[model samples]
Target: MHILLVEDDHKAARLLARGLEEEGFAVTVAHTAAEASSHAHAMWRFDMAILDWMLPAKDGVALCAEWRQAQHQLPVLMLTARDAVADRIVGLNTGADDYLTKPFAFDELLARIRALLRRAVRAQHGILQVADLTLDPATRAVNRAGERLDLTPKEYAILELLMRHTGAVVTRQQLAEHVWHADLIAIDNLMDVHLKNLRRKVDPAGLPTLITTVRGRGFLLAQPEGGDA
Candidate 1:
């Protein structure tokens, strides 16, 4: 899963990002609300957001409100020093799905994150499917044509991303940011390598490409009515 972490403290941001990455999550850190907004505007789609209530400008509450207003329904976890009931209420009211106070145990934070993710998956039926390709995020399982497919972590991540958007053409930049968490322009060829491996596993006997390149744009997972050629 890819997460957007908006924290003003550089130390805290790095520590949280490192821990999240170690837990098998791709994290993008932003020190301010403006920086967070910039990242959101990019092609990547974050599964969740961790925002600090206190920020240099446009605090977390405002940012959360903005996201809700824009209909960005991703779950948000608000982190702050304020632990009062009133504060928690305000955070939730402003569209935060969860709230955590500072000085809390890292384990607890991680647990809360997992819980929120579980809730999201449940809401979406716990499985993402396109055509005959199926991915169960909870089980980390993939099946194509009723046959189980063993996929590398990278392959799974890329396929999960494409499957989430289904027929929509997912940009190379989006794949790099969410799957590889790297700069797309510098690692274009690397992205290609992963995609090639993914295609081999997904459509080994390739005639009708399940994942199709959009020429200069990017790639799209074929939809039920077949995909745009």
Candidate 2:
């Protein structure tokens, strides 16, 4: 898993990054909120983030709030010296999934990280159904009308995004960012090819098409007329 570690303490950040790397995780260290924000918004996808409450300027709580406001689903774990219940409540209220006080044991920190990751996995794995189509996020399985459909990784990612926003138009930019982790212009043709293939497989002969193209806007995955998604 990839983790973004935001800590202003140079020595502490290094040690934590080293330990996490040793534990087989890709770690990106940011010494300030600005740097952390850049990393978070970058192409590199991180599974989780560990943020220090105390920073040079903008604090971790504010950063976490910003991320939440922007609809970034990356899990955040806050680290701080404040051990009071009020402080913990404030952190959690501001979008921190969990909070760890300063001088915490390394082993405990690792355990907490593992727990948060597990919770995230479970949340992501909830079965998604849009009309006859069903997606199992855990197994990466896609089925329509009880028939299994083989899909490329990119195709599956695109379909998942569409299914999640069923009935609502999902822009090409959103698909490109989520599936390819790149700008739409960079992969416009590539996205078209994948979408075509996906439509061919999912909308086979005799089956009501679920995918729709909203001209000049994007794509929408929805059920047929008189049916709800």
Candidate 1, position 180, lDDT: 77
lDDT of 2 at 76: 91
Residue pairs with backbone overlap in model 1: none
Clashing pairs in 2: none
lDDT of 2: 0.89
* lDDT string, candidate 1, 1-101, tens digits: 88899999999999999999999888888999999888656524688999999999699999999988988889999999999999999999999999999
lDDT of each: 0.87, 0.89
Instruction: Please state the error at residue 36 of candidate 2 in Å.
Output: 5.7
Tell me each candidate's TM-score. 0.87, 0.67
TM-score of model number 1: 0.87
Which ten-residue region of model 1 has the weakest summed lDDT? 220-229
